[model samples]
Target: MLRLLINIFFLSLVQGSVAGSEPYFSLADYDAASDREYIGAVGILSRPDLGLVITITVQSGGALLLGDPPVDKIPSTAVKRAVCGQVISFPNLPERNLVCR
Candidate 1:
């Protein structure tokens, strides 16, 4: 009985941890000039000891034009702020390519 209870408790903790680490899909607009689209996975991990950690993994990205390459300015702060599933745009670039959702 004690072993079963301990196993159940561990199972619950594992389930909660897995649930907390699930990644969510978000739109990634690497290029606003083209009709292409992209997708990214955003995941947030939190622990009482570790505070919070945000992770943005690009699942798929759009293609760049022949003469146009990606800009060096990536709005990481804006992306972190907009992680709650909101559209974010980067207006500093001339072509305005870095947009995240």
Candidate 2:
């Protein structure tokens, strides 16, 4: 049937062009190294029951800047990059400097 309709239109155009084409985070770059940016931040990773919304996004150079829904609204729920760096800004976790656990 026409090569299965051209292989389902090339697998739906390669799955809709890689579905949103991953790769987002970019807080200018890196941040946490061992907490101190405010006595809070040591490789972010928190889940007092999904208390904090924003998920993951951490480079490894310095500075760190880029807010307002930039780093693709950070969200790595599976818990890989392992983050919870002494943060405080969920309901009242405030004391921020770094976040992404």
Q: List residue ranges in candidate 1 displaced over 4 A.
A: 1-23, 28-50, 61-83, 86-101
List, residue by residue over 15-79, the lDDT tens digit for candidate 2: 12231333322222234564324222223324456443333233343322122221323333332
What TM-score does each of the candidates earn?
0.21, 0.20
On TM-score, the candidate that comes out on top is 1
Q: Name model 2 segments beyond 4 Å from true.
A: 1-23, 26-42, 51-57, 61-101
lDDT of 1 by residue, 68-101 (tens): 1111122334323433333333233222222332
